[model samples]
Target: MFRARSRTGATFLALAALVVSACSSGSSTSSASSPAAQAAELAALPEATPSALAPYYGQKLRWRSCGVPGFECTTLRAPLDYARTDAGDVRLAVARKKATGPGKRLGSLLVNPGGPGGSAIGYLQSYAGIGYPAQVRARYDMVAVDPRGVARSEPVECLDGRKMDAYTLTDVTPDDQREVDGLVDAYKGFAEGCGADAPELLRHVSTVDAARDMDILRAALGDRKLTYVGASYGTFLGATYAGLYPKRVGRLVLDGAMDPTLPARRLNLEQTAGFETAFKAFAKDCVRQAGCPLGGRGTRPEQAGRNLKAFFDKLDAKPLPTGDADGRRLTESLAATGVIAAMYDEAAWQQLREALTAAMKKNDGAGLLVLSDGYYEREADGRYSNLMYANAAVNCLDLPPAFGTPEDVRKSLPTFEKASPVFGEALAWAALNCAYWPVAATGEPHRIEARGAAPIVVVGTTRDPATPYRWAQSLSRQLSSGRLLTYDGDGHTAYGRGSECIDRTINTYLVRGTPPTDGKRCS
Candidate 1:
C-alpha cells in the first residue's frame, strides 16, 4: 500500500525505538473575507443546521473515564450515509483531555495524525493529549475522533494475520508474468475480503464522508467553529472540511499537506520521487557514519542508492530468515517497506543504518522485519491492525485507481523508474492494488478554495518522503486563506518534530489565532 504515514504523534518513532533495541537499529488567500464577515455569512447559511442532520448535531456526548489518567472517551453517532438520513448511524470513538487551564479556555482543539486509517483517538491518548505544548494544552481541550471505518470505530478488516502476512510478502517488483499474476491476485483477494467484510461501510469511507463526520463531531462538542491540526493524509481531510464549511474553519494547521488537484497517477509518481529524495538524504548521512553498509565516507548518494537497490535485488532472489514465530521471512517488499518507514523521520536514519547493517552484514533480517511490522502495525502475537485495510478503503474510494490494469502499470514503469530507480518499480506496482478495488471512486482531483474560511496554516518539509513539499505549495496556492510555512528539513511533517521555529509559529497560531505571515520559511 502507498502510505503517507503520520509523523505528528511520533507513533512510528516509538515503534522504531523498540526495533533498534532488537537489532541495534536505531493555506492561501484569494478570499479577502474578514473573520467577522465570514462569521456573519456562516450564521446565514442554512446547511449549517439542516433538519436531516439535526438529530446528529443535537446529540450530546456522555464522556466517562477511559482508563487513561487524564482523558475521557465517548461515542459519536453520525449517519452512515450523509445523503440518506434514514440509513443507520456509525458510532465514532472520541477522546479528549480537558484543558489544564492556567489560561482562559479555548474551544476544543481537534487533531488527526494522518493515516486516513490512523486512530485519531489513539494518537490523542498516546501523544497529543500529553505531548502537545503545555501552554496550548493549558488553554484548549485536546480532542480527537477516530473517523468512520478506523480504529475503535467499526474498523474495516480485510484479512486475518496469516493472510496479511502472505499479502505483504507478495513480490511488488515483479519480473515475470507469473510474479505479476501473483501480485494482482493478492490485491484482488484483499479487496474482495473488504467487500465481504463491510460492503456498505466501504463505500462511505471517502475523505469527504470523513469531513462531514467532523462537522457532526464539532456540533456535538458544542463548538461553533473547528480548531484543528491534521498531518499528512489528515491535511486532505481538514482541507475538505474547510471547503465544505468555509466559515466554520478556525485555527487549522495542515502540516505535511497534500495537493487535492493531482490525479492518482501524478500523486504516486511524485511520492515515488519524494522517497528517492529522502533516501538520498539518508544515504548522504549514512556514508558519514561508522559501519555504514551502503558505502564509506566518499560514496556518492547515487552510488549509495545503487548499493541499497542491489541488496533488495538479492533479497528478491533469496529471502532472509526473520526468526518470526509465524515462519515469515524478510522479502524484498518487506525490506523496502522497512526502509521507507524510516524515511518518514530523520531520527530513524540511525535505525535504518542499523537495520541495513544487520540485514546485509550479519545476515539477520529480524531488525528489518521489526521495522516493516511497525509500518504495518502488526502486533507480536501475529494480529494485524486495521490500518492498512482502512487505508486502502479510504484511498481507493477518494480517488480513481492509478492503474486500470497490469498493462497500465507496465506502460507506466519507465516514467515511475525515472522518478526513483530504487523505489519506483515497487511503488508503481503497488499503485495497482487499488485497481482491483471492489468500489469505484466517488471523488476526483479538484482544488479546495475554502473561499471565505479563516486563515489556515500549511507546513511542509523539503524532503518529506510521502508527501512532497511541492504539494504544500500547490495546496497553499489553492486555498483562499492559506499561509505557507516551509521547513527546510527532512521528515514527513513539521510541527512537534523538534523544530522550535516551526513549533513556535504553529503554537502561536493555535493559541492566539495569529497565523504566520504568508510565505513564511522556517529552518
Candidate 2:
C-alpha cells in the first residue's frame, strides 16, 4: 500500500546513494523587553494565547549544544490535547543553528520537511542546518521541531520489525476474496497495533494539534511573528498554522503543496494521477536511454507503462529473490513501492532505469529492494524508523478514511484506474489502510483562508509525483494572501531541486521579505 509520505531532500539524497550502491544507493525571537511591549505583542498575536496555555507559551528553552556542530537542541512541552489543557505534557524535540550574520537577523526561520512523519529536527541536523542557501543561513537562525508523534518526539510505535516487514509485503492488488481479506486483515492489525501501543497519544496527534505546538514553539523562541519554509506534507502544516494564526505569519514558503480542501479520496486519486504524470515523464526519458528496460527509443509512454505493469504482474505470480538477509523477495507490492519512491525526484530516474534493467532483464532484485527499503526508512539492521507509523498516525487523524471498507475501494476502482491505469488498483487499495483506524478523524477537508497573513509564497512543481501541481494551485487560490510560484519542472519539491529561478525567487523572498509577483513562473 502507498504510504503517501512526502519525501524530504535528505531522504532523497540518502536514497540516491542506495540506488548507486544497490544499484546502488529556524529562527527566534528575543526575551528582554518592556512588560507593556510584551503585553501589546501578546495582544497583537493572531489568536490570543489562552490562559491555560500560558505556561507552555511562557516556558524557556534551554538550548544545549547537540552533537551536531553549530546546532543546539532543546525540548518544548506542549499539552497532550489542546482542548484538554490539564492533560499531561508531550515533550517535542527541537534543534537550531544560530544565524551567522553580517546583515540584520530576520528572526527565527522554522523548517519542516513534510512527512507528516518526517523528523523536523532530523532535517535540521542533516540538511537544512547546512544545505540551505548560504545567504539564508547567514541571516536567519535555522530551526526545526519534530512534530508530535514523529522522530525524537514522543514517537508512536505499532508493529515490531518482523511484523512490519510482513505488512510491507502484503499484497495490495487483491484478485480474490481471500486475498482481499488478507489485505484488510493487515490494515486491521496495523491499526490495532498502534492503538495497543499508544492509546492515549494516538488521539492527540492531529495536524491541528501539531500546528498548535508550532505556535507554542514560536512563543518560546521570542519571535513576534514566524518566518518559515515547509515542503510536502509540511505545506499543509504551514497552511494550517497560517489559518490559525494569520496575523502571526511573517514570511512563509510552501513548496510541493497539498490542497487541504480535498477529502482523502480525492487527494489519493489526484496523487495517483500525479504519480502517473511523473511516471510518464520517467518513461519518456527512459526510452531515450541506452538500456531502458520498459522500452527502447521511440516507444510511447503508455506502452512503457503497460510493459512495467506486466512486469509487476509477473512478480505478483512469482516473486524474485532480492538477496535480502531477511529472506524477503521482490513481490509486486515491494516492487511498486521501489518505483514510487524514485518518482519523488528526477535525479533518481537514471538509477531507476538501472534498477529496472537489473530486475527485469537480469534476475537480480536487490536494486529495486534498496529503493523500497529507503522509501520505508528501513535500516540495514531490520529495524524500521517511526516514519511509517507516524505517517499513519497523523494522516488517519487528519481525515476520515478514504474508503471505509474493501467494497468502498472496489467501487472506486474505475475512477482510480482512469486516473492511473498502472498504479490505480494498488493506490486505491492503499487508501483502505485508514479504514480500520482506531481513532475517529478529528479533521475534515476545508479551505484555508489565512486572511490577514503576510503574503505566503506557494511553490508548485508541475510534475511533483506525490503532491500534484494542481494542489499547489488550489492552495494558493484558497489563501487570501497567497502568491503562487510555479516551477515548470519534475520532482516532489521545487526549491533546492536545482531550478535557479525557483531558488532565487524563494531566497529573495525569504531574505528580503518580498514575495515573487503573484502567479510568477520559474524554470
Q: Model 1's lDDT to the true fold?
A: 0.81
lDDT of 2 by residue, 282-301 (tens): 99999998889998999999
Candidate 2 deviant stretches above 4 angstroms? 1-46
Model 2 TM-score on a 0 to 1 scale = 0.92
Runs with alpha carbons beyond 4 Å of true place in candidate 1? 1-46
The superposed Cα distance between candidate 2 and the true structure at residue 239, in angstroms, equals 0.3
Report the number of backbone clashes for model 2.
19
State the local distance difference test value for candidate 2: 0.81
What are the lDDT figures for the candidates, one per model? 0.81, 0.81
TM-score of 1: 0.93
Instruction: Write one digit per residue (lDDT tens) for candidate 1, span 1-523.
Output: 2344463111221111111101010011112322222221111133548888899999999999999999999999999997898989899999999999898999999999887778898889888999999999999999999989998999999899998888888888889999999988988998999999999999898888889899989989999999999998889889889988898999999999887766666666677788899999999999998789999999999999999999999999999998989899988988988898899889988888999999999889999999888888899999988877787788778767767788987888888788888988887777676677898888766678888899999998998877889889878887899999999999888889989999999999998889999999989
Q: Against the true structure, what is every candidate's RMSD?
A: 6.8, 8.8
